[model samples]
Target: MSKAEKTKQHIIEKTATLFNTKGYISTSLSDITQATGLTKGSIYGNFENKDEVAIEVYKYNAGLLGKTLSRSFSDEYPKALDKLHAFVDFYRKNWKFVFSNGGCPIMNAATEADDSFPALKNQVKKSFELWMSKISTAILEGQKKGEIDKRVNAEQYASLFIMLIEGGILLSKTMGDQSFLNHALDKITHMIDHELNILPS
Candidate 1:
């Protein structure tokens, strides 16, 4: 990468966690400067403004989340049902990585950006749309492969799963009770086993 691109990436990487944990409005330029050890002019030279920089940071944060989910869907699970289970197991096992980073980036960003920060809000919206689409696509694929029930509604289950996961994370983070998340995951597991999965007669 060119020097400018490298510098811009440096700024994004340094401030991603700070913005995720602190929220955009609360995270000031000084925080980025302190975290990145770069001067205001240096940041400005790389980014058009704070909002622009924040947009890029949100992309970086969202990218991190995408990588995690992609890894969760890795080749270990040959069937879609197993892939879904692996996805849950990924989060369940990575609670520390999730909670330590102040919760899911999409959830945190959307909650913080609601009715505010239009550009950032739109970013959050796209992230969710992509997530929902992924889940729905997986459901449809499973149905085609005879792994999931053909009668199940792909879009419906997709939205439901997102709601469950995001709600679970929010409750767990706010209540200081990790079991809330596990409880939600348990419900998801039930839905998958009894509702989505096809059991042999």
Candidate 2:
């Protein structure tokens, strides 16, 4: 890519975790400069302002997560039901990655941006919308294929799944324990098998 594009990406990558951890208000220009090894002038040269840079950083952080989940849906699992299971398995297996990266980016941003950062809040909302849509789509597809029960409410379950997963991540991060997330995922598994899955005839 162009020099400016690469530099912008470098800043985003370096400060993504910083913002996720320290938050938008708490993460100062010094933090960005320190993380990216760029002077304030260089940072401003690459972006219009801190808010602009933060918007991009949020995208970068959320994108990392979105891409991985996207793969779980597209790759390895042909059946929609299996894809849903893979979704839970991903968090179960990769909670460390999520925690180390400063917790789930969506959760991080949601808490920070809800009241103060409107721009970042909008971005977070879009991410949630897309995520909910994907999960609901998977459920609807499964019903069509006869793998999932048709009576299941795709949109409602999608909302519940996001709530449970995000809530689990939040609780886990707060408690400094992974079992909170595991408990939430366990509930999801039970819901999938008993509430959503179709029994063999």
C-alpha RMSD of each candidate structure in angstroms: 1.4, 1.3
Q: Per-residue CA lDDT of candidate 2, range 1-201, in tens?
A: 999999999999889889998997788899999999999999999999999988998998899899999986885888987899999999988999999978998988898889799989999999999999999999999999999999899999999999999999999999999999999999998898888989732
Candidate 1, residue 60: Cα displacement in angstroms equals 0.6
- Scored against the true structure, residue 138 in model 2 reaches a CA lDDT of 93
Best by lDDT: 2
- Residue 168 lDDT in model 1? 90
lDDT of each: 0.87, 0.91
lDDT, model 1: 0.87
TM-score of 2: 0.97
Q: Report residue 22 deviation for candidate 1 (angstroms).
A: 0.8
Report clash pairs, candidate 1.
none
Best by TM-score: 2
Candidate 1 regions exceeding 4 Å error are 74-76
